[model samples]
Target chain A: MMQEIRQQTDANAVHRDLTRLPLDTPAQQAEFDAALQANLPREAAVRRQYGMDRRTFLKLMGASLAVAGFGASCTARPPEEKIIPYVQVPEVMVPGRPLFFASTMVLGGVATGVVIETHQGRPTRLDGNAEHPASLGGSSPYLQGAILELYNPERSTTVRRNGAPASWDDFRAELAGLSSANNANIRILTETVTSPTLAAQLVALVEMFPNARLVQYDPVGRDNVRAGGSWLLIRKSTPITVLTKPKSSFPWMRISSLVCRVACATRGTLWPATPCAKMQTRPA
Target chain B: MNQLFRPAANTIARLSLLASLLAGVVILALLLVNDQSPYTRASVGIAIEQPVRFSHKLHSDQLNIECLYCHATAEQSSYGGIPDTHTCMSCHSQIATYSTLLEPVRTSYATGERLVWEKVHDLAEHVYFNHSIHVQAGFACETCHGRVDQMVVAWQAQNMTMDWCLECHWEPEEYIRPVEEVYTFGYEAPEDQVELGMQLVAFHEIDVDRLDSCSICHR
Candidate 1:
């Protein structure tokens, strides 16, 4: 290998004219002849004196064959990748790129706006939506980890009743049967629901059954504070403490101000009696 | 008689061994050369088989549809974004409704299953490339993607190596085009290309030093 490399380097230096050399002297010619002789077929006498035995030769052949076989087997042929195009491609997607959709994920009864990065149509990543009010370009750990949950293989894929597999249709049919039966003992048990649609549905179900009752229970919930807030409204008029911090991370724009308004409406009086409250009430 | 045959057999054995060694070396060299060649890469200059035989040449070159019409997020997001099935159905539904070639497309639409497209010019996972930043920098899509509008199958024309990216990053004035012509497929250089590009670079306030930083692409 070394000799071959040296010859190749010399050949390249000589502009690839391999037919003749500029050997000017007999001594130089002799040196060239010796170098050429070194590459010629060796005599049997030299082989008998110093060459490896048949055992060594066989061992070498076995090693070389094993190495070559292993190398050949190790090289993974890249799979024949296919590009499956959309039969009816959506207006928002392109062929070779990822698309982001602005959506919301419910965490602890509050909806946090998130932007999901979809490769083809499968959600692969999640980030907070910069434009959304709940999440201003920042996501909680739960929202960030939602993509993993979306792709989790262990996630339940079917509805079940009594630990037996049942489809969504079966569940719906059961719900229909219960509603039609209209039993006087019918009761609805649920966790605190901030969603207006779900709350309305529960209210309508109770109204449908004259003797039916609806109960809200949560192990870790904010409903207690909300219930206390309602009681406070009915009882003695509590002093509205307007806590305004000058250094605010969130912008006091339409979104944050609306949040403040909801806080005031639920827990305390909306009217600002203090001077600081009046000063901080400017719509920014 | 036995001694005479033994020498002859030994000579033949030695010759065969030498021949096998030489053959192995030659085969190994050929394999190495073949592996390094562009033809073996399978990504460049070869037509990638897609589910639906979509043609960019027909849409962009013949029909004159803008690149951004389908890749709507190119200028706004990090990704250029592949169009959804509904986008193709908007046109293909009427034209190729009964064609057997569009069977996959129709099947996907009916079943609501997304077609998984194999990316032709995928970068290393560690490298982060933002298409919006490049578009905002006034670099034409063809500058990196090559003449995709002219291709029927859209094979990767360039190697897309880090070295190749660095070549333009070192001298971005030569690559920068006007923002209006960013989507142009095969833009020709004007007589004063260098001067115009330099002026545009200045006008756009593109920080050349910032572009050359490792964090710019690697992050």
Candidate 2:
């Protein structure tokens, strides 16, 4: 029955245009007749499986509905609901009104600034932050969908060590033990450090240990763009994207170059150039 | 063959038919009574218990504290907000510091746990009501709430059914008063209430035609 509906839907799509135009021609009439004829047999088979005529089915349905209605009317009262008021409400928070906070979400080294709407304390919705250079009141589908990730059930909710559940203190103690060893090769693997504070911390960590290194790795990294000689240069604290015209006439190269230019221009100081490179090459 | 029925049988049949009709009428009357009863409505003079028994009579009547002092959002937001525990402690901390009755309020303030207050005038989820709009339109708080200053415990005074809402929506001029009288507990409507209300409605630019539209409240 499901397969029959799907076939009918597919057939309907093919004849969708035919509906707008009049079936004036004999050929058009014949095509419509053919589509209808194809569906009639399956529909007849489904009706036969039910083994009840329209009148009999209606009578049965009416009788059952009357019984259900009688049963439902016996219970009149709805379940009681309670309203819990905050002990010490925040100065800014009003019970019914939603509050918005400016934040950033990063995916594949690209950061988008967003304003999150929170009810009481839980984040409910996300929109583009109007003031941020990365978004400028416009958001991509990725930024809009980032709110779902906060409540994603499959997301890792605890620290793990060697594929087993571990506490943060345990991880910290182990890290301290590892760092105490003078010749330890501590490699911190992260996905795109965009925040200035995080980059500073990474730099400080690398400086602390002579052999320590930080590697920013994304599955869909812009290695091709870097190889294509599209560099985002920071001159006088402002990012300038000098799009060096593609040496080759390849379509992908041109598209990549365009994306690089847009990413660099809109991204601005979101991904700082000096600190990012310094953190990467300092240990090396 | 003897007759299958006697004259007495015909009377019995007619009497049975009349009894069935009477039974139907009695059942319908019972249903109507149930529909209008306070037990079914679960509101209108039903004072739901709260974690802390806060008295509006003492606060708003004796002390003469404004309704907006605690329910501050009523003038601005859709909800007549239940005051935070902090709002209660602001005064209770100094005045009734060690009162046994205020133990819940103190516990909530100290432990940072919320006090679950049962709603007295709960509306259906589908109905969209904005207290700010009504208050701003010179609809007195007492008009629907009914002398809250006199009640020891807060109870819903109005049924707040769709029909009750339509009574005002159809003829708003019968109820609307001056804006200043909105928060007043026992505001008496002037003799020329309809006349003043008509002018106020025009002054507020309220479109009477749009009031009865389904989306006005349902949405």
Candidate 3:
């Protein structure tokens, strides 16, 4: 049996060498001949030794056939599954048909509008919402990955204090105690605020604590580019740039427009050029 | 050689050999029978009980209510959606308001809890059966369901095995009818069924060659 296996491996090596050989040149033909000569003698020697008698071979084959026959009968019937119907079906919902809802996903301070496709109340897919000013029927990998994040099992579900699980009531009581201490130093750390409701809340929180400080920080913020004099304007957290600098000789070839186009291409929030109207525009 | 076995022992050995052969044959036959039996398939004539004893015979056969009235999405959706509690109360609120038979339905509507009806005809998970495509192809409800209007307690009428589905799919021209007769129960094919089915197959634009493809049903 060992001799037969060795002979089989030798034959396989020869077959592999033959397939790998490019017979287009005389050198390759010579190499192929060398490989064949090296393996042929060992194969012949191994073949001369007998592996198993016919009777033993027949017995093993018969045993395998019986085992296979028994294995075939072992498959059980499929388990039962239930189909639970809704108590009150939504007006617009039809079973097996998907409904798309317009929503927004925020990442690193930028919000992109997306259309989420839901099947029977479970969101199954996501795409860019065309009607929204921020999306304009375009999407990014980060926007698509939001679905994975939404369904991620490792996502934080409850309040935690210093890596240990805590409750909201306990946190609220601690916060009340700290505020009532009169001279407590409170520092609020948050991402860049864009939503009007959140911005108003943060302002009210500071007003109530008098000495409390609010710090807005974004890891991927374009502060470096702004400091480097890149003509990028920030107005109410929306990145807007002057498309046509009137005083410049070449208004069309302005670097600011090019930078703005590249920066805001995925954002799809290019404001209409009205010479910086209303709100004060700052570099950072 | 030493007379260790009696003369009658030869007859016993031969009789035992024959009995063993008979037993093997009997076991094989039983296995074959069990494979095709309703106990294994769990289908055909097994009426599963539901929370409410809703009778198809009364609603469909006696009252002559159309099948589409309850399963409205059957023509447009893959699923023949089960009627919600609101659909039941649509009629029961005025008709069977005080009946004890509809107490579960009333309680479900009042509390906004779903009625846990037992599923009768459950298909294999891999088989992606669509009702709308079959309905649009002009296959009558009775073609596969087999006189559901006659069923007092709903039961699976056909085995619905892969071979049973392939029988219609293999030769769609032999089964299809006019679109108007899709919801008509107890519909009988005409004498010129093959000829009419051929026309309907073309009218419905069903690709016969693609019907038998693995992805068509499996996917």
Candidate 4:
């Protein structure tokens, strides 16, 4: 295995003409031959003394079998390409034929309701995934068509190291550095998280790194909630709310699409329906 | 220095020099090819192999067991689904109760453990999955799901994604609902799409005009 791996490595590593050797001079060949001869087994050397007689015997025995089996495979050239085309790829392959699967799913938002679909897998057309309780079998198109956003290909691939490839060790080292910093000085920001376990872990990390701090920023802030969540500690507590509009990790605008109106905090407030209107072009 | 010590030291130094030279040459060649020094994390951590060997075709074709008996909730639940240990226990407890094929399951029950069945379909984090709706709406557990009774150890037969899913929903009748013959492991008409589309349009009062809107799903 080691020899095979070395051969592969040499094959891959040497891209130039290898037949013309830089080191295999006549003297070097003679030296290699002498070294090889010195290492040959004594039994093999004795067998060589018997010379062509034994070879002739083995050659006669091998010829009969080789002649019999060679007939079928002699002229076979491998086809240019081999394709195991699916024997029956479903006649549903017809262009006009549309097949649908009714699977239930959730529509993410302030409401975050369940929905059903009368969709193909793409939601080329939509109906809710009706059986789920939240949608109550009736669905709006927003929840029905969300499947399109899932496959948009623009999702972030979790790249790190300022766009350079990075090792998990590098990530761990950076995180360790951040944790080692003063909790009050280090800021870890996130949207309102639902998992209790995650919340507990965050609290533990916060206590461990007293100098480390957290900053929560919502793109679309619920007027009163954002005001309160932000001011609680501009330097400490994780500011989170349902409609302060969590920062979604979706690469396209679709990530934020799931965030609903801040009806709880905005009922009587002056903020517009779409919060994008509220963000300043540049921070003052 | 003595002759013995000097000769040994010279060989050691020469071998080290050769090894270092080869290492440097390899590293330099990689650098020229723009090869990264560090490899990336490209996959997840947890992967477990299944215990039993089961064939879908044998159960589905030979015994004629329905897909839903094992799957149970392909159309009615959020999980297209995996039968709970009890469900497996229900039948195996009586039929084929003593077989080694069912022995591992017995071990799980004795230990109060869940047999780690490897999941075949892995959906994107963004999409939702449900089974009850499909089952209740007159779809056989076999249609979009593929045959399960035929499988001993369940394997994913279809690519489950948003596009493949939506295409199934747009006109379900083609892939679904022959009514009398619910389990379809065989061929059907290719034009069933338009036929099913028209049937769905009539069956459910969906306005075809607004079907393609992103808000139908994105929200």
Candidate 5:
């Protein structure tokens, strides 16, 4: 019914276009205003509820008053020189000085540990985990920019359902439905997760679904690394053998009279934090 | 007569409009907070103030209390964890009962709150400096911490930059990895790293071909 009403047009739609014309000059605009003023008495029954009562109408009047009073005794006075009295400076504040503290960040997804530098309350930058698996102890350039991601104003705050704000209860109900439908046969599709407890939880969840199959879908869309490893060893346990430095850092590796790969490989053995290279025989 | 009546009515209407606008502005100012902070630092830096003027001289020299006695966790965690109010209260709870220095500690304890300690020494945001790894590896609290046992008010000793960290690491024997000779305090190395590396190689039968690689440190 509301849609149908919106589709219909008012009898005054034709005359409304006349008032909508953008008069460029103040004189023309004033004439238009005068014409509007002339019609006000006719529309007074409906116009009293809005228009003059609208803040926009008041603003229009205020602007016009400012323009009208531009000269004569109404000439603008110079803005008040607001001498904001200074507040007492706290003894602790030294304007240019910043203090740093060491903080830890959990590595998400494929990355290893990262140490963060916190200045005041703001996380300023990421350093290598220095002692964690995956990254070994070194940080990649990609990991360095995580502080921006942490403080990004545009990051999503809450989950949404369709276009509506979803409540925790509503989400739980959806999950419950999914659980029942699977009926002791559920599959949690994930990559090569090395977490033992998580695998156990997945098995427990599968017990709920009658025939749920946990399909392994590598998010990288590659499966060469997915050929099941023996229970004795995990793939992640092996350190990166050919830890190649970023090309910019080691251009000599590509074009040198003396090839630099062996130096890079040997350097990894000596230094833990630089470009740690592994045997080239291993697939990167 | 018409002109005189029109101007009077217009003036009254316009005055009413201005009054309404002024009222709206006041309402908005009440609704919003002024976001601009005069100081970029936190709470005008008041939150970062030291609880007491803890002297390294009186504790480290006069009483011979080890630097680690006060900042006990420096050798264990990423944070040389600042002693909580309770740690201060352990002694101050009785020893300095009447002193003005212990007043804040007592007040914090009575209120069931923690001390908000102002840190003096700081490191860079991009560097992941470890306390335990360095401590366990036999680096003194002073090497990177810069002679805190001698400081009156523990201030940052090292500039703690990438170059400084790398400089120390580059010559591991001088500043790092060589624990036996660095600390004058006679802190012994738990395991000789070079000897351990050798023994592990021999026992595990790990050839140079199968050892921890560069990915261990620089990811």
Candidate 6:
């Protein structure tokens, strides 16, 4: 008998934190509300009456102050604001409406499809594209934070070599010189690439230089299942395993399996209510 | 005579206080009223300057080109994308390539840079407005944007406040039109507009409750 277990540890995947208080019932909500109310300032009765907390009331007050300050400044004799109209307006762009473009965000060689919201010409926000298979309308944190990265003031605007500014033409000319040297002692190192087109390009580059070599280094390493398969042959041992029956047939058994802890059930499976409490391992 | 004068003085003081209170109320009301006035609404009537002196009046009214020819994304995406430089060169390459006015366009095309057009009807950062949903819901381009077809220099027509958006969302029947008539400028509502609007709302499956939620526009 042999057993192979597949485990998913994609850090980008959504995981519910077990340490957080679970508010699954109305009782929990009422308890939380009570706790919040107990800590509220005594002077915030007026805010509470309007269904607002002290924090929200303070925020509103701050916003009012900011607005008043802004309004006072605006009333002063400032330079006249100019309105620049287009000489030839594109038919598609409305003067004031935001536009969305379908784009992809890559993290660790995996691409997640996202929709980029552009105001004027700058990308302002990123939302998961529902049409894309990888995202399914939910975005990872990387995709959500991409807009800040786009607007980051400290991001590189030009190519650099050894902390000095460089240009693409200069780099290309340098590469051409090296290629003409016929130096067979070339080594190209890259992170794990999943795209076939990129792989093909790397292969072509290696072929162009007869002695050139390409090496892929992945920080996360390869799948453990493949590693396990090879180890089983080396040891020549059989691993005993037990598979849980359908939840309808054996509900208790299904609930006890550790796999049931994280894997959502698609058919006749009940979600473990108590987190780790339901992880029951049985002898095969 | 002294006691009588004291009462008179008290009455005068009371009357003056009341008069001043009324005056303050009037002044505040005037300020509030002035906020939405056409003169106070920035860029409402003023012609905005552009890199190119493009006239909507000439292209839309004179040339008879459809609004969608340039704003192709409005029907499918949240934005009506500004046309690329090629879109300009498509016509101006042969029409007015040598004109001083077309110099910027030529330079942008030659250098592969974009002409940054000044935005006219920009909304606040908090509000989430989708152009496609309105267009798909049978709203004419002029419904919120006013008449761009006649604008020599495009200007803001609507106040574009939360109250203005809520007023329409609460009573969308007045604004709802046929999908085909959505692009039609100066579209008039039918005589039984309220009843027709009710039917259209139901047909379109527009959840009135959902539309009125804070999250609908805020996030």
On the 0 to 100 scale, the lDDT of residue B53 in model 3 is 85
What lDDT is reached at residue B24 by model 5?
68
Query: What lDDT tens digits, residue by residue, belong to model 3 across residues B157-191?
Result: 88888888999999998889899988788787899
Please report how far candidate 1 places residue A92 from its true position, in Å: 6.7
Model 2 C-alpha lDDT per residue in residues A125-158, reported as the tens digit of each score: 9877778765566655566677899899777789
* Most accurate candidate by TM-score: 2
What candidate 5 gets wrong by more than 4 Å, as runs, is A1-284, B1-49, B176-219
For each candidate in turn, give its C-alpha RMSD to the true structure in angstroms: 16.6, 15.3, 14.6, 21.7, 19.8, 19.8
In candidate 2 chain A, where is summed lDDT lowest over 10 consecutive residues?
A275-284
What local lDDT does model 3 show for residue B171? 93
Interface RMSD of each: 11.1, 12.5, 12.2, 19.7, 17.9, 15.3
Off by over 4 Å in 3: A1-75, A154-187, A217-284, B1-36
lDDT of each: 0.69, 0.75, 0.75, 0.50, 0.51, 0.68
| DockQ list for all candidates | 0.17, 0.28, 0.23, 0.03, 0.02, 0.10
Query: Could you tell me which residue pairs clash in candidate 2?
Result: none
Worst 10 residues of 2 chain B by lDDT: B1-10
* Predicted candidate 6 versus true structure: per-residue lDDT over A1-284, tens digit per residue: 12222223321121222113234478864654554444434523654578765456788999999679656744632234433435445556555666789987754455667889886577888877878755555555456777898879777788676678899987778668778878656788877566789989999989878889888775654334335646977753322222333455666544334442232221111122122223454433
TM-scores for candidates 1 onward, in order? 0.56, 0.69, 0.67, 0.33, 0.31, 0.54
Model 6: reference contacts kept, as a fraction: 0.05
Candidate 1 residue lDDT tens string, A89-189: 56676544678999887654556678899976989888878886555556555666788999897777888777788999998888787777777567677
- Ranking of all candidate structures by their DockQ, best first: 2, 3, 1, 6, 4, 5
- CAPRI classification of candidate 4: incorrect
